[model samples]
Target: MALWGGRFSETPADAVFALSRSVHFDWRLAPYDLRSSLAHLAVLQSSGLLEDSVAEPIRGALNELISEVAAGRFVANETDEDVHSALERGLTEKLGAIGGSLRAGRSRNDQVATDLRLYAIDHMIEVAQQILALQSALIAKASEYGDAPAPGFTHLQHAQPVLFGHEIAKHVQGFSRDLDRIHDWLDRALVSPLGSGALAGSSLPLSPEVTAKNLGFTSSAANSIDGVSDRDFVAEALFTLSMVGIHLSRIGEEWCIWATTEFGWAKVADAYSTGSSIMPQKKNPDMAELARGKAGRLVGNLTGVLTMLKGLPFAYNRDLQEDKEPLFDSIDTVLLVLPAVTGMVATTDFDREKMALAAPLGFSLATEIADYLVQAKVPFAHAHEAAGKCVAMCEASGRQLHQLTDEEFASIHPSLKGDVRDVLTVHGALESRTTVGGTSPSSFKQQIKESTAITAAYSKEFTDKAKAFSEMMGA
Candidate 1:
């Protein structure tokens, strides 16, 4: 049953139908479409378009249809153009004539817009929860590796001594902001477009607020044209998902490098890793590599959607049909990625001995020597030059800065007096960074505590929001 063919004497050509069909990718929106239909049904009855006698049976049938779809007993058929068409076809079959009235005050334009919003909200909650799960794993890793000194890099070369946990916390901070962006995106996505019938709304006295409230939206769209047309929510969702992909990619890149034989800093678990086909010695971080690779796909999804939206006029367009596959693919990709990476992080073993051994290489503690000289009332330029000379002398003699004798230090600089080597140790270097958010043990522990609180707080907030939304949608 085609949704619109009364004006045409002939049926759409098979090629036309083939080009127009979206049921393959869009059938997933059936549940949201049905929920929106039920809400619209109530609004119709309340406005006297559908009498209670007709409305109640339609309601029962819609609910029954929802159950059937959930049980996989009802599904989009080959003839159905999209999820909305398939579900409407189901409803009309049940009610004979009354099911057709449910479309009285809504269009596929607004209907699809609302359904997409609902779908995005539901999955965004899931995605946000998964992000928090990854954050928790990282937090646990940070706590477990607390104050273990490692080489912190600039240009991928050792630049300073830092606690390994602090480096993990840096990733946590990025994910934390991703969580914040999700929260912000939800605020803009919560408005309903259900009542904006085909862009200009209806002549009937239908109340958009009634459907909006029933569907868990904070409010109805203010402008009827904008309601059916606005896909900013979808764009924002894509961007947020892309950021998540980028972050996961960073983790993947780091783990890939860390698991290398040359780095020897970490090892991915056997379950999360793969062996080579031809070579028996390979324990490849394939999942990490995939996560890195999928970031490009997620980014492409965003770019594709934006390009599709860029030149379109206001209100609904056929181009909007291009939005869902990319959006859906990105969501699926991120959902698939978060847990695998989290599991990898949770199960991986870090070689603390190797990391610590590398922590002081490449004169990473030269800054400490400069700071030490400044504490003795020497000019900073003189102190900096003295530290550089110390590094040069150590390099010349094939020794570490800490390996230099006191006489060797004195010859390098007049201020290289007694116990200058005291600041040369890794622990000393780490401990000396005692400011807030520093790599010192005390500061690292505090950072872990703060991150734990943040995850807990966001988890509760999103969980509560999801619960309320599900209840409002009668899910």
Candidate 2:
């Protein structure tokens, strides 16, 4: 049954019904809608808008409907217009006239806004937890390969030696910030829009606080118009998830490069690698490739929803329906990518010797030489020039920096007269970075310790919130 029809003499055209149908994608909001209905029923009864006799059976039916929906026994039919319509149709079928009274002070506008927040907040917490799981995998792998030296790049060319573990830990830092963004997004998302009927709130004495607490919102919306129209939470969620996708893409890009035959610095497990359609020798990094490609898709989803929102006036609009598919797709994409990429990182093996061999190439140790000269009291400008000269000389002779003889080093500068070759090895270069957050073994180990603590703390916070949500929902 249509929600509004008494004013219209004729039924809506088939094309109009088909074009406006949302149950196809929005049936996923069924459980949240049902739970919100239970909360609404409580308010209706408390405010005397609904008698206990009416509210009691409606409550029982709503709960039963939730179970049926969960069990896949009750679902949206071709006649159903949207999740709200489909659910109201189910309720009316059960209680006759009484089921229809639950709509007393609510509108589809506020109901949908509330449903989306409930749905998004639930999934965002899950996504944040999945991110922490990925962080855990990286921490484990970093600990496994402590102080294993690798070439660090600037402009994709070798610039310095870094511990392989340090490179892995850098992704964790980006993901940690993503978690912070999710936490901040929750601050705004935790408000209820249920009582903000249509645009202006109802004149009825409905207790919004009761419904808000029942549905796990920290408070009800203060302004009815903003309550119904605001979708900043959705946009922020997209931005946060897109950041996650971008960070995942970075990992994908680096892993794809490292797995190449020419680089061979890392190897993907057979389970994670894919065979080429035509080339028999291929074990392609398709997982990483897809991860890299999905970043664009997530960004596109964010952009589309924001554009849809930008032109609309305050209060609810049909354009707002455009928000769900993109938000849902982004959440689904991140949930899918996180586990696959985490497995790829956790199971893959690294070739420490291969990475080490490339560590000192492109004169990556030139900075080490420059720093060595500065320690001997040479002016930094002169030291930088001397280091540049050494690189130029090595280029002319087609020799590596370590191959330079002591007499040659002495001829270049007075500070190079002694055991200047001492700082030339890859191990020496890695160890020289002894500062906090540096590539030294001590710093790398300390990083692992801190990340482990950080992951544990975030994991705890999510766990606590989940418990609070369960208690609030009476689950």
Candidate 3:
């Protein structure tokens, strides 16, 4: 019989039982469920709802069940409705009548809520660690390539020359914001929802604070209905992971472009690349392609959960059962992909000569020409027009900006002196923008230093939290 089947005239149909079962996906939460049970049992004993002797046996049985599950000796059976039901059966089988007291002041509604929060907290730390690893790889690459010139593009056309490190720093800064979002979300997600019962407060004088502290939560939920009903934390976590996927996709797209023969700016390492079956010479960036493709699935998971929650009324509902898979998938996909992506990045070989060769193509020095006119005290609008004329003149003559004769420059604008040739070189153009956050070599080196420090701080934060959680779980 089902756990809640006392009022039913008959057992659920086989199809209904199979369809309603969540053990396949939620068995991952079995440990978390058992942990919540232990904490709730303590709350019950402290409130005098259960004898200390009864609670002790129940606790001992739960500890044994935890060991069994961890060692693969215990698992949910065919009749088990969910992880909670499966573990309840295990506890009952171990302690008989004493196990029945463990459920006195709790319901599956609040229980599952608490379990999911614990799952989120644990995985959030893991995902943050993976992100930090990726960042470390990026920083290592930037350090290796220090100020190597590359064409910076706008709208798929070469717009200016920039250090390759500058481009890597942009992604690093984006991931820094992602880390901030995870930490901020954890602040709200760490609250415990135990003792909320089945969408209402229990009459047994249960102390939510005791359960919250026992389970490592910073606080307890203030409202019973919201405690059981709210899945905003799951949605937020998925959104955060979606943003991570999107950032990774952007990096993948760039790697794909850079590895193409036409660009020839970088090569994916042999270990991370694959070759075609028919074409013997094709070195395919399969890792980057897959990272790009999986981003869509991550995004889809976010929308799937959001759509699942949009029309539901407040308080617990059966539809909430749909939440776990998408959350699980998002976490799994990110954890699996990030390490591979990190390897792909860390092992890449950049062709500095090729990047430098392409850096100043397509009249990329036009901006520097305009800035030269501005430095000569020409009106800003006139300087821009004069620079446009220089590009037009170069296009007409099949010559680059630096190749134009002084006579030809003089014809375009009076400020176009021979000194204009100085700024036309790629290195000169890159160095002229000396303001903070520019692509100059000095600016890029400073950025790499700052990014390294920030990454170290985040690494420490994640490590400290992981240790604290481990200590709490052991306690």
Model 3: pairs clashing at backbone N, Cα or C within 3 Å: none
Predictions in order: lDDT:
0.92, 0.91, 0.90
lDDT of 2 by residue, 141-160 (tens): 88777858889998999999
How far is each candidate from the true structure, as Cα RMSD in Å?
1.4, 1.2, 1.1
Candidate 2 error regions (>4 Å): none
Highest-lDDT candidate: 1
Q: Write the per-residue lDDT of candidate 3 for residues 290-352, one digit (tens) a residue.
A: 889999999999999999999899789999999999999999999999999999999999999
lDDT ranking, high to low? 1, 2, 3
Q: What is candidate 1's local distance difference test score? A: 0.92
Ranking by TM-score: 3, 2, 1
Off by over 4 Å in 3: none
